[model samples]
Target: MRIAVFTTCLADALYPAVARATVTLLERLGHQAVVPADQTCCGQMHLNTGYWARGLPVVRHHVETFEAALDSCDAVVAPSGSCVGSVRHQHAMVAARYDDDALAERATAVAGRTYELSELLVDVLGVTDVGAWFGHPVTYYPTCHSLRMLRVGDKPVRLLRAVQDIDLIELPGADSCCGFGGTFALKNEATSSAMLTDKVAAVTSTGAQVCSAGDSSCLMHIGGGLSRLRTGIGTLHLAQILASTREHPCPVPEPRRPARRRPSLPGAAR
Candidate 1:
């Protein structure tokens, strides 16, 4: 199968390795992976930030970039569920706002070929284990957009469970948001911080060395909170874990001091 990797803007800038891992995992599974250079932001940040007028050009750029690859490849996969959701769910809304009939048509075609990592793996590739070999207990944080908007429940968890040497733990309150809704963080700083504190507390409660999810943007936000608190817990994207093997291990942050105690959930902490 010919597949194109749409490395979202956040991944391109902050998590390039995640993008590489996504391609590596696909190729290891005996498929062709393509990275279209022109791919950029999926206009999700803008769309969510209520900058519809400012998002049109970005929407156009992304649509054009992915449309070419979508026409050629059997599927277009992204490591980010959020980005895939944007392309699949929001492109039509954005296109319609401008009344650009061509853009709207192109948006529909492009969105059709895009799939989040788990969707491609379990739905298209028909495999749970991507033959991963990460040896550690990992906790999961389901990103809000992917969980609520995309409704990509259990796809990631199912794949994680299939990996050899992986101990997947249930994150208490795993469905709660990580408080990083793009501009939501900036617009409501205190509320965001409070919410992030709750998420970090949940991460610490997991007593696992790593916290992972399908979205890197959420990881960045959660990682930043953990980093700030000087907690040793690390955040990883699910693709990174799925891509790990005994030969080529997923790059994890070096271990620091183990957490002193599992943090209690809000209102329950003593």
Candidate 2:
């Protein structure tokens, strides 16, 4: 199958490795992966922030970019469940809100072809194990969008379980949101922090050195909190974990370092 990768904004900016891993996994499975340079954010941030008007252009651009790529690719795939969920669920809503029937129909058609990485691998490609191997204690946290919005249950875990020598641990409160609902964290910092505290505690209790999730946003929040506490646990995208192989094992990521505190001025108190 010829697959086109929809590298979301978060992955493009903060987690390019995850996007690369998605492509690597697809190619390793004997499928071609195409990444169109014209592809940009799916406007999920705008839509989630209630700026449907502002998001329509972004949604339309995405549809146009992929529609063109469809000439060479059989399907569109994204490592992010959140972005896929937006394209599948929110794009059409934006069109309908504005009563753009033509755009709505087009949006629906494009959404139908878009798939989360695990969905494509298991349902479309008909393969569980992609000959991957990652020998370490790891746990998975199902992101909110992937779980509730996309309804991609067990598919990611099923793929992880098939990895050779993988010691997959069950994460306590695996379905709980990691307190990173995009702008929600910024809007409700205190509440977000409290929720993150619980998530980090649950992750630590599993005694897993690494935590994996489908969405980079959640992983960034969870991983950042863990890093601040100096927990020594790392966060990885499912794509990176799945791309690991016996010949080329996924290297354990270095613990994230906390930002350095700036020095006080000469007259200021220490």
Candidate 3:
């Protein structure tokens, strides 16, 4: 299958390795992965923040970009369940709110053809085991969008379980949100921090060296908090784990630097 890779904004900017892993995994499975240069954010941040008017153009751009790639690609795939959920669920709503029925129909068509990485691997490619091997105990956290919005239950877990030498442990409160609902974390830092505190605790309790999730945003939130506490646990995207093999094992990610503090005004406090 000729797959068009929709490298979401977060993956493109912050976690390019995740997108690279997705492409590598697809190619390793003997499928061609084509990344459209025109692809951008799936208008998720804007829509999630209730900026419908501002998000319309972004939504339309995504539809047009993918629609243009249809001739060269068999289907569209993204590593992010959140972005896929936005494409499948929110794009048409943006169009409808703008009274663009024509665009709405087009967006719906594009959305129908897009698939999250696991969904494409299991549902479209019809393969569970991608010939991967990782000899380490790892736990998975199901992101909110992948669990509730996309309803991609067990697909990711099923794929992970199929890996040879993988000790997949159950994550306590696996379905709980990692407190990174895009802008929600920024808007409600106290609540978000409290939620993240619980999440980090649960992750530490699993005694797994690494925590994996489908969405990079959630991982960033969870991973950042873990890094601050120096829990010695790392967060990785599912694509990175799936892309690993006995021949080429996935390297443990380097520890992230804590957020820098703003400089104090000169001669103000001292």
Candidate 4:
């Protein structure tokens, strides 16, 4: 089972480790993972921020990159629900919005084959426990795009539950948004901060050693708050958690300071 990885914007720039862990999990399962070196942002941020027309080129580039990869790969997978949600649900809409029916059809075809990491493991591969070991008290947060947009309900939890020696705790208000809606955090700083405060409290109340989510963007947001408050709880992506094994365990990531790289998404093919 050869799979292609579509490493999204945040993961590519800010959290390459998460993308690498996705490949590690796939290879550990005896499936070959190939990264289509040309893939980049699926124009999700452009569309989300009201640059629908400008996003069409990004959308078209995404469709072209993966459409080529799908020629030989069994499936396309990413660790991000937000980017996958855009590919699956928004790519075609961006095309059709400008009367590009040919591009729209191509985007739809590409969208059909893309999957988030957990969905690929659970639904496509029919394996919940991918022979992983974590051995830590962890709580899982389902990001908004994966929860509402992708409807990947409980698939991540199912994967986490199967880890060896892992003590999974229930997150308080698990379904509530972490308030990291990309630019929403920037545009409405006070509201976003307030939401983040609530989310941090909920995460702390769980008494888990780490907070886990499928999206790196959300983890970064939650992690920054945890760092500022000097909470010992760390953040780990689901792929990293699943990629953890006794032979080569994933070290608990320290809460990152707000100082990080500015995301510059090139045509990773634009």
How would you encode candidate 1's per-residue C-alpha lDDT over 118-220 as one tens digit per residue? 9899999999978998898899988887787778889999999998988788988888788888888999999999999999999898878899999998898
TM-score of 2: 0.94
lDDT for position 241 in model 4:
96
Distance from true location, Cα of 252 in model 2, Å: 0.7
The local lDDT score (0 to 100) that residue 182 gets in candidate 3 is 94
Candidate 3, 48-131: lDDT as tens digits: 999999999999999999998877889999999999999999999889988999999999999989999999999999999999
Cα lDDT for residue 269, model 4? Answer: 38
Task: Kindly report which residue stretches of model 1 are placed more than 4 angstroms away from their true locations once superposed.
Answer: 255-270
lDDT of each: 0.88, 0.92, 0.93, 0.92
Instruction: Tell me the TM-score of each prediction against the true structure.
Output: 0.93, 0.94, 0.94, 0.94
* lDDT tens digits by residue: candidate 4, 134-170: 9999999999999999999999999999999999999
Pick out the ten consecutive residues of candidate 3 with the lowest summed lDDT: 252-261
Q: Give lDDT: candidate 1, residue 112.
A: 84
Kindly report which residue stretches of model 4 are placed more than 4 angstroms away from their true locations once superposed. Answer: 256-270
Q: Candidate 2, which segments miss by more than 4 Å at Cα?
A: 256-270
Would you list the clashing residue pairs of candidate 1? none
TM-score of 1: 0.93
